[model samples]
Target: MTIPDRPLEIIWDITYACPLRCVHCYSESGRRPSRQLRRDDLLRMADAIVAMRPYGISIAGGEPLLVKELFEVTERMTAAGIQVALFTGGWTLRPEMVGDLARAFFRVSVSLDGATAEVHDRVRGRRGSFDRALRALDMLAGAGPVFGIDCVVVRSNFGQIEQVCTELVPRFPGLGFVSFGAVVPEGLASRTGFAEHELLTEEQMAAMGAPAFRERLRALVPPGVHVTATDNLALQMHPDRIREGQFFPALQIEPDGAVRAMPAYEGTVGNLLTDSPAELWRRSVERWHDPFVVATLTPVRTVREWAEATRRIDYHFASAADRERIDRRPAFAQL
Candidate 1:
């Protein structure tokens, strides 16, 4: 398929500061990173985003609530007529904050790893995190902005997928959808050596995409609830689509102001603060020509390629020399 002229969506990791240390956090965020883009810089980038006019932008982070100027940023974006989505762990969401978000017409997607407190809290690495998240969901339900649940499917909570869809999701009044993201073994997952233990095996991932399992999930998911799986590439990357070529419709802005074609991939296209969003986006599209990016984007081919890409990308970020190489390469060079 031909690539779109512009991105359909942008996912920005506005800050790398988070309150919770989830076992599978792709950013490995906890305490605020020592280096982050200044508020003025980010606001300036927001201005550029307004100029680009993507259909939607998802503001995310270790915990977006930690950003002191989050509300200000959201208001500016909303006032500019850009649809914004807030992706949070929900630990810091307050009634007043929910009200603000609702007024801005921002959509919220809260993380919920399991159906029950015990299961959820265990993954979040906090004892009462599940309750806090549920409370935030309740507040958002009545606050008026569209909201949904984001669950990272891992070995610990895979069995509760049904309960999350049937029991947990239906209890929230304004819940719009439930997205199941396959746990990617990157970031903290790799650092802690939990990739092998926590991530679903290749066989398990394939099983989740099997016709019978998908039908089971379909039957169990309640009416009015839409279910989406981010890592269900086995079902999405059809052979024909691969042959024809496909493009992912989103770009990501990291907390430090770097723009990347894919969040998990370590290649930086540009910095949102110093570079125009349009130019960065153009580079993101051009970077697709890189063999590494092509392998990362192409799915249902082999688990080994995916694993190696993740490892190499992770290593690229881990090494200063590698990052220097990226900085020196041409804008369209394979990251």
Candidate 2:
């Protein structure tokens, strides 16, 4: 299919402040400052997205439940006839909020990286997060809309993908899809200290995305439910589009309002705070032909390579200067 004028889906990371510190966190969320746009600024961003009018928009963050205006923004988008969804770590997701959340969101995903608390807590660097996630899911299970879990396939949890699907599928009647994200080497997973023990080999990642393996896992769940294994590197290749010279990468709106082509890389297209989303959406159509993008993606084959490839690209501020310093200082080090 050809690239649409509006992105099929948009992922907006509203804040970097999180409660848990996962080893494979793409944003190093809790470790970084929560560069939240003020309440009015956030509503303005929502207005901008409404104007862009994408098919769907996912509201994500360190923990979206932490943002007091989470539902307000979601309600605005929903009122504008846009499909709004939220992906949360479930740290502060309350039972009271689940009813309204189920009503407003197109899909509600709570992360459960592992089936058991022991494995999950270890990977997430928090003692009681597993239970909290489960409790949140329980509240949301039959509340309304499409409810599901997001499990990142990692070194320690590689074997548990099927187990998570089978166990979770029958448990939550409202559950729709289980996404097995092959952890890309970016953010915290790219940190020098984390690169060695935490990352899974390329072979292991491929095994899950393989068609036969995914089909087998899908059989373990009900027929209506879907299971998918996605490695972001494969997405960078834009496998389904069949186009040449240009690709429509996953559009991500960072907490500071920058619109990044792919969340795994720092290269940005524009910032909503500085430019209209409509204007930035127009620019995104031609971003694939840039010499830097072409050269960077030409040799990328694996998730780890994706991390190495982006280091050489010169990230820019098409709308405004960068908002934060990526530091190696002791105080600013990875958590």
The most accurate candidate by lDDT is 2
> Residue 150 deviation, candidate 1, in Å?
0.6
Per-residue lDDT of model 1, residues 1-335, tens digit only: 76677777878888887778687666657733524567887788678677778899888887888887887887888998899999888898877787788866567899999999988988988888899889888888867888889888887898898898788887888688888877765555433345546767777687665667666776776677777765544222333453566435677777877777555556677787788767887887666555654555455354444555566655553447445533432221110
Q: Go through the candidates in order and give each one's C-alpha lDDT.
A: 0.71, 0.74
Tens-digit lDDT track of model 2 for 1-335: 46676767788999999999887777768877898988999999888888777888999878888889888888999999988888988878887897789768988888999988988888887999999988888888778878788888777888888889778667877678888887766555655444555566878867866898888888998777878876545445433322652343457888878887655555577798898766777676556546666667677766566656544442332222322433441221332
Which residue pairs in candidate 2 collide?
none
* TM-score for each predicted model, relative to the true structure: 0.84, 0.87
